[model samples]
Target: MSNEKRPYKGGHGKPGHAGKPGNGKFSQGNSNQGSGQGEGGAKRKRRRRSGSGAGVNEQNRQQSQNSQRTQNQRSQGRPQKWDDNSRGDKKRFENRGENRNDSRAESRTGRRFDGLTSVERAARRAKTEHDDTKRGGGGTSQRNKSGHERNRRSMSAREFSAAAPSARSRTADTARATVFEVLRSVAESDAYANLVLPKAIRSHRLDHRDAGFATELTYGTLRHQGTYDAILRHCVDRPLEKVGTTTLIVLRMGVHQLLNMRVPAHAALNQSVSLAREKIGAGPASFINAVLRRVSERTPDEWYELIIEDAKDDTERMALLASHPAWIVRSMRQALVAHGRPATEIEQLLEADNLAPVVNLVALPGLGSLDEAREQGAVDGELVEGSALYASGDLARLESVREGTVRAQDAGSQLVARALAAAPLDGTDTAWLDLCAGPGGKAALLGAIGVQRGASLVANEAAPHRAQLVESSMRPLPEDSYTVLTGDGRQIRETLRKNASALPGSIEPGQLFDRVMVDVPCSGLGALRRRPEARWRKSPRDIAELLPLQRQLLDAAIEATRPGGVIAYVTCSPHAAETQNIVAEVLESGAVSLLDSAAALREVALHTEGANGESVSVLAGEKDPGHTPEIKVKKGAPAVKAAENPTTAQLWPHVHGTDAMFLALLRKN
Candidate 1:
C-alpha cells in the first residue's frame, strides 16, 4: 500500500522559485524534488477518463492534484528575487535539475508507477480515510485502507515510493512472513545473523545508520526475550505460549521498544498499535495498544522498579529487574565470589550482560600499529593498548578492515594472546599451537606474529567446519611457516613428539611452542550483547557442563607448549570456573606457572579516536586491575616449583568498552 499515491499540501519546492517560469512549485507525488517538466496536460486529461473510479474517486484525485497546484501557486507567490541568495539558489536548483533527469531514468516494478500518480493519489486518500476511522472512536477495523490496503496492493510491482518525513518509511516497515521466514531459515538453518542482516539491509537499500539500528533492535530484542515474554504475559490476555508466534514476535518487538529503548511513549504505542492492527487481527489491536500504552506510561527505570517490586527474593530481584534468568543471576553471583570479587559487584556483572560490545581491533604488528592509528584520532584503551586497532568507521565495513590489515577482535582477547605471544619464552625458534582455533581469529594474528618472528605455528581445530576460518586467516602466508591441522590438540602433541627426531629444525633447543593460545569454547555469557540469545540459552549449570571441556582444552594447550612456554587461556565469559579456576586447577598439577599477562600486553600500543575525520589511539585494558599487573609464574626446570595462582584479566562492560572477556596467560616452568 506504500505505493498508493498520497497527497501533500504546499509541499513542492517554490518556483524561478518556478521551474517552467509559470506555476512553479515542485510536483507532488514520489517524483524527485522538482517542478513539473513535461506539458502533457491533454494526454493526462484523455487518460483521466479511463481511470477506474466513480466521480468521487475522480474528485478525490482532482482535489489532490488541485491541492498540489495550489501549493505550487502559493510557493510561486513568493518574490522571485531575494537579493544575492537568488543567484546561488538558481545555480543549486539547476544542478539539482540535472541530477534528477539522470536519476529518474531507471525505474522498475513499484518504482515505475510514478506515471500513475493520479490513481495512486486517490487510493491513498481512501486509505487515509480508512486509517482515520480505525484510529479515532471508530475502534479497530480490519478494513484500514492505508496500511492493509497499501500492503495488500503492494503484492504487485509499481514504480512508486511512499515519501515519508519520518525516520522509518513504508518500505522499511514492510512486513511479510517471508522476511522472518528467510531470516529464521538463516538463523536456524545457517546460524547467519551477521551474514543475513547485512545482505537484507543492503538489498533493501537501507542507509548505514538505519542498518545499525535494525541490527540492534533485532539482536537486542532477541536477547532480552526471556524478560520480554515475562512482562508480555502480564499484559496479554492469554499465556504468551498460547498466543500465535507472529503475535508473540510483534508483541516482543513492541515490548522491546516500550521497555528497553528511549522511543517516545505515544509514538511507540500508537505506531505499534497501528502495526498490531495491520499485523494481527483487529481483535488484538486495541488490546495491544492498551497494554503497550500501560507499559509505556512507565519509563525503563520505572519498569525496573516495577519488576523489582514484584520480586519476592534476591534471585527474583536480579532476574526480574535485570531481565536475566534467576538461575543465571545466581550462577554469576557464585562466579563473582569465586573470583574474590564482592557481592555488591553483582549489579555490575548483570548490567554487563545488557550493554553492547564495542568494536575491538588489532593492527597487523609490523605494517601498522594501534598507536599510529590512534595518533590519527582513534582513542586509547588501558591494556593491550599498544597493538590496539581503533575501529575505522563502521567496524563492519571500514576499508582497512576489508583489506584484512586489521580486524575486529576483543581487546581482552588481544591482551591475552599478545601477552603470550610476546612473553619471553627464551627460545629462538618455537612451535606454537592455537588449540581450538576454529575459523582462526586469534590464530590469524598469532600466525602473522609467528611468521614475522621466526616461529612455526600449528593451528588445530577439532571442528572441521571451522577449519576454513583457519585456512582463510593464514591465506598467502608461506605454507611452511604454519600448519592447519584438523585433529585433537592433545593427540597432535603426541604425534609431534613421536616425530620430533624425524623433523628437522622442529626439535629446537626448547621445542614445543614458546606460547600457545587456547581460545576455548563456552556459553559465551560475557558476550550477551552480541549473541542476544546467549544469556537466555545459558543454564545455571552451564559452568559445570562446560568445566570439563574447558579443562581439557587448557590441558591440551598447556601440554602443547614447550617447557617454560606460555599458554594464553581465553574466553568471552568472566566466570571464574571457566577462567581463573581453569588456570588454577592446571597450576595445581605443578606442571606450569602463571605469567603477568597484563605487563606482557602493555608491550603493544593502542588507538582510541573516533573513526571518521581525525582518527587517533588511547590507552587500553588499564581499567581492569588484573590486566595492568602481571600474574605470578613458576621459573625453574620444568615442574621445578609449585605454580602460582594466575592473573585473570576481566574487562568491564563500560570501562573496557568491549565484551566482558577473560584472559590469563600461564607459563610452563
Candidate 2:
C-alpha cells in the first residue's frame, strides 16, 4: 500500500543521510577535534592575540564582544524572526519560558488536562483567571556563569576582534530552517497550534515527510515535556532553572530526539549540541552532551519502569506513561468510567493522543454525496464504515474543500450531527438550525445533509464575520436549502416564542428547524495535538470560566428546536460538567424530552439480546448479538441512559478514530 510503501514515511533506521554526532571542541579521532580552547597551544594564541599594548584598541575589543552577543537577538527563528543587532544578549532567548523575574517555584496550573485516572481531576480544578504574565525570555546570557551576574554584561571598547560568533550555527531541523523556533513561539506566545504548524512547515519549504517530522517533533516535545525535562535535568550540569530559555528549549528539542524520536541518537545529539554551543556559548555543550548520553543509556522499557516505579497507583502510572498530569487523568477517568471504560484505558487514551491522527473529511451532503465525492478522487474510502475517506494531504488544499463541497470535520462531529438528524425522515424539508456555525466545518456538513434529505438549515452565529463563514459553509448547496443569520441564537429563539415581543425572528413558524445542533464552544481541551501550544497555554481554570458561556449556548440550542425536534448537545470535551450535567439540568427544567439514540440510530447499530459474544459499552442482555457500529439497532435506547447507558461518550482517535465529542440526542415532547 502507498501509505506503508511511501518512501518518505520510513521510520528510523531507514536509509537517509542521518548526520554525525557529538560536535564539541574536544573529542577523539576527528581532524578538528580537540583543536580549540584548553588545547595545548590555546594560551599562547590568547596571549599573542591579547596584543602587547592595551589602549584604544583594547577598549574597542570590549564593545565588539557586547555587539556580537547583541546581534544574535534577531536570529531567523520565532522568538525573534528578523535580525537587527547592536543590542544586549537578553534579546536572544526570550521565548524559552525561563524568565529571571518569574518565580522559580511558580504555581503549577496548566497541567490539569493531562488525562489522569480519577475524579479528583475535576474537584481539584481551580479558576485560572489570575494575573497573566507574558514570557520575558533572552534578557540574560547562558554564559553569564553566575546567577548573580548582571542582567547586561559588556566590556569596554578595547576588547578583541578575533572573538567572533561560533561557526556551528545553521538554519534548523525542519524544512524551514526556523520551524522549530516558530513552533516554540506559538507554544509560548500565541498558544495556537492549528494556526502555526502549517505556516511554519510551508515557510520552511519541507516536503510531506519533513513536514510530518517537524509536526510530530513539535507536538511530541510538548506532550512529553515533563519526562523530557527530567531526562534533560539528568544530562545538563548546572541547575536547568539557571539555563537560558532559548538554550533550554534547544536542549528540550534535543532530548525529545534522543528519547522518543526515531532520528538516530548521533544525529540528534550532534546537530543539537552544535546548535547549542553556538547559540548558548561553549560550556553548555559538553554539559548537554553528558546529560544526553546518560539518558540514552536506558532503553524505553527501562525508562518506563523507572518513571512508573514512582507512581503509587493507576492514576500516577497512567499519567507518567501517557504524558498527562495526574489531575487531568483522574478527572477524565471518572467521566470515562461512567461510560464503561476501565481506568487502565486512561494510558491507552493518552498514548493514542500522541499518535498522528488520521485526517477525516466530510462530503458536503447536498453539494456532493459521499459516493459522488469518492468517485471524484477521495481515496481511502470505506476505512471506517460510516466514514467515506480518510483525509490525506491538506484537505484545505483541495479545491473541493475550499469551494465548500467537502469539509475537514471529525467523524465524531459527523456522528453528532447524524445523531441529531438521525430520526426517520418523512420526505419533506424539516427546519434545522446549526447554532454557532463559524468557519463552518460541521455546519457545512449539516447543511449538506439537510439539503440532501429534503430539509432546510438555518445557520445562526454570534459574530457577523463568522456568520459569513456559515454562508460560506453552505456555498455548495442550492440557494433555497439554507440561510445564514448573525445574532445570539438563544435570544432569537426567545423572541420568536415570546407572546408580546416585537423582536424580528430569522424564521417564522413552521420555519423552525426540526433538529437543532449546538456544537457549543468550550475550552477546546479535546484538540491538544493539532494545537500544540494550547497545552502550555491552557490552565485548569479555563474550564470553569467557560461554564456560563457553555450553559447559555446550550440554552439557546434547546430553545431553537421545535417541539418533537431533536437537539444534539455536543462539545469536544468529555467533561461531566459540560456534557451530562448540562443535559441533566435541561432535563430537570422540563423544557424538552430526551429521545433514545439507539432508536434514532436503529438503522445503524444496537442490540438488546446477546446473540453472540461481544463487548459493548453497555450490553444488557444474555445474548450479545456481537454489535458493531455498522449494525442497525432496531430497539429502544434512551437519550439519557441513567447510570446504565452504553455510550463511551464518543472518545476520539480511540473508539471512532476521530476527535473526542460528546453526543446526546433529545427530542421535544
Question: Which candidate tops lDDT?
Answer: 1
lDDT of 1 by residue, 279-326 (tens): 444435555677776666666676666556767898888787667788
Error of 1 at 452 (Å): 2.4
**Model 2, stretches more than 4 Å misplaced?**
1-163, 166-169, 173-178, 237-245, 274-294, 369-392, 424-429, 463-469, 494-506, 509-511, 532-536, 598-649
What lDDT does each candidate get? 0.60, 0.57
- Candidate 2 lDDT for residue 644: 25
RMSD, candidate 2, Å: 27.5
| TM-scores for every candidate against the unseen true structure | 0.64, 0.64
* Model 1: residues with Cα > 4 Å off, grouped in runs: 1-196, 266-290, 367-382, 386-396, 476-479, 494-511, 601-624, 627-639, 642-646
Q: Model 2: per-residue lDDT, tens digit, 286-320?
A: 45676677877887677777777767898777767
Model 1 lowest lDDT segment of ten: 152-161
